[model samples]
Target: MDEVPGVPAGLLGGHPRVLAAAAATGRLPGRAALDDYRAAGARAAESGVPLRVLVETALVMAESMDPVPLPALRRAVSALMEGYENAQRLALRQEEVARREFVDDLLQGRADRLAERAEHFGLRLAETYAVAVARPAVPLDDGSVRDGTVRDGGGVVRDGGGVVWDGDGPARRIEEAMVARFGSHNVLVAVRDGGLVCVVPGSLTVATGEFTHHVRQMFAPGWRVGLGRPHRGPGGVVTSYREATGAIELGDRLDLRAPVLKAADLLVFPVLLRDRAAIEDLVTTVLSPLREARGGPEPLLGTLEAVFASQGNQTAAARRLGVSTRAVTYRLERIRRLTGFSPDDPTQRFTLETAVLGARLLEWPAHAPG
Candidate 1:
């Protein structure tokens, strides 16, 4: 008789029918053979047999033991189930450890064998991918908030207020939800730095708006999402992750009310923030005059914001500000006189618009030291 791998040799030696079943299905016998099956499960776990395969083996073993007395076989099946559960748990735990290590490597850009490691973690490195970062929208009332910077495992410091997420329950729930929306194998989620970061494949074809809407509905209110644009390859994934992080930081700084923010929509902020000295200079040179306006900077700043938001259309700006078009035009004229830059000119408009964005990001007059 041919020997079955990982199965004890002498255990099924006497039963020809059981031996044939084991040989054909790669399942151990059952009933009086419970001990051997349990042992086989342990060996399989150690040998790296997949949990799904082990489960099927257990079911097949129960079916093959049908000729045994019903009550006795039922007891044996119960024992087999326990053994399978233990083996699966052990395998799953080990996989989790390996997966965490891979994620850390990926995030840190230290993964040399990217393709091999990604495949081991059931990820397709070559596929188009995007990264998303989600955090609890509501700050904890407890004074546990830390004042310093919060950095992820990858050592990327996301500039935002920190929250101490105390448990894995929410993270796990998010992972399950993402897997349900995008298939289990296509999405990899890990909780890092008190937030959930997910690497999801683009093959799911879910639109960004729809994806964020679904995520918001799945979680509790006040959950904010930062989604990155899709890019190809593992390096692209890292880039997307950085974009997602930047989106969150920018959104928070700007006090954007939208629950979901896309990185692509806010690329200009990062570019402007890249040169701190330059942005500060621009704000000082163009907007400093507004601080000395007749009614103080608030009214002029409000007018400027309204006009820019309305795309330089004085009529639209006036409607938004609940004032007459002539009033809006007069404010724009005052702005030009004070700053020597007219909002109506294309070149000056670009400069003023950029400066306005910089002021918002820096919290300008509000950021002035007390």
Candidate 2:
């Protein structure tokens, strides 16, 4: 084996040695050689060695057996190669399974030897980590994934719960892009609960921007990305993941138009939702009068939302609503007259804006509980 040209010392194994002996004997190796080759292939896959190199080395070993019949040697090498390929496939499947399990544990905050497992995947539990989650604006299909086999729009529905996607979907593409930008060691991308989750060191200020860039490339205007603040330790991964997921869900509920949302920026929303009774009461009391308007609460509600969104500028609100400034003024007056809350007064404006946000959050009038 040492005498074989172009064969690295680390790659020298019983399989090649057995094949050489069989070639010298003008016969192919039996089962033992096949088992050795399979083991070698698994090692090669783990060490990042190319199969082409292995094949070329085998050819060199075959060539060295001068005056020996080539048929037996060729057959021996063929058997060895088959074993190698089979082992490589097995190694790959096992690697994928390990990765999936590690990601699930990390994101779900499962602490069963999680710190030790994190090291296996190149994660440093001492460092702070942030999570970014992304999904298509419109889900691939309306079907629920079952038995870990359903694939929709490149997403797989996990049997346990939520989408667990794989293959050549947006998740794969995003993973590739992120790895290309940040290097594989710096980022971990996985499909969990039906969306793509990217875990990157929180210190990388541009990480989320890079994530957003890649997501936008694949799903412009139709995708949403939620970013969670970085937290330290293994549990931090789970915390950040939850924050990212929460941001995405909140954005959906609030009808937020922004493609990118940060959990830190929307902190007030969770606070508002914490006391549901208080918010519901606020919405019903301050804005209920608009229900009596000619077109019901929607028109008046839109006026308030637009006015507040425009920072009290009637002209900008009008532009947003696609109505004339005079119309906006009239609507504002109608709201004041109907609800006794004026958008022009500073204190009243604050109360009106909070109620309006609560209304959107509660899906008032249209879906609010009767």
Candidate 3:
């Protein structure tokens, strides 16, 4: 066994003694001897020795022992293999539990022993970190749609296409890929609310795109990514996570088509949301008049949205609205007459655009305050 090239060094130091004791049983190893061998197998497994090498060593040793029968040797080896597998399975399970607990504590701002656990998980609390959260653009059927509220403390809410935490498949795949690509340190990927959330060092410029690419490759297109800026310390993880979550919810509300949304780019929306009363007043004052238009406010609101998105190009706005250019022009005229704001003017257009964005974020008209 020591001469075997593939065998892990020091793995066979005590194995010979255990195998000899088992071989003394003649036909089948006694319980005591088999138990000792099983324990030895577990130790080897814990030390990261390959099972194949251990098994091959046992078979080779058994060949040299005259008293032990092949059937008894086989049974003893089977017990050893079972012990090895059980130990490995338990280790893997414990690792997974630790990872999930770390993720929860970090994301939810639970600071109990956070610094200690953070070190164990390869996170340096002193350094800056950013979070990237990704999910299928079209929500998957996670069966939790009817289930109210976030279950895992991952901040997955029922805003728009809530990312329900599915099984471990996607998360596992993403974690493995990330570890392979970025090495096993300072990168953590976990499943929260059915989306893959990755915590990477802020210095990685391509993390956002790389994470999105992996998700798209694994789950296909129709996936969206939200990224949060880098922040320092344990509290930074929480802040970045919430930022990513808000970006996804905001993107969904605005029906954004971008594959990746950054919190930095959407900072203005949160500023607008900070004064809900003020924004509501703005939406109500600037846009509520559109309700008087024929076919209610949706058609006019949609036309305004298209016109702003198309940068005042009437033909492009018409194409987007699937109406004739004349119809778009007529809607703009109607908007001007109704709200005294012109999409044609650069100054007034800004006010109209901001108000329109506020309406979407507030889910106006349908949920508009009376």
* Cα TM-score of candidate 3: 0.81
- Give TM-scores for every candidate, taking all chains together and pairing residue i with residue i: 0.63, 0.79, 0.81
Over the stretch 158-214, how does candidate 2's per-residue lDDT look in tens digits?
323443334456667777888888887788887666566789998986988888888
Off by over 4 Å in 1: 1-90, 138-170, 180-182, 202-210, 293-303, 312-347, 366-370
Candidate 1 has an lDDT of 0.67
Q: Could you tell which candidate, 1 or 3, scores higher by TM-score?
A: 3
Give model 1 RMSD, 1 decimal: 9.4
List the pairs of residues colliding in candidate 1: none
Q: Please tell me which predicted candidate would have the highest lDDT against the true structure.
A: 3
**For model 1, where is the 10-residue window of minimal lDDT?**
150-159
Ranking by lDDT: 3, 2, 1
Poorest stretch of ten by lDDT in candidate 3: 150-159
Worst 10 residues of 2 by lDDT: 156-165
Please, what is the whole-model Cα lDDT of each candidate in the order they appear?
A: 0.67, 0.75, 0.78
lDDT of 2: 0.75
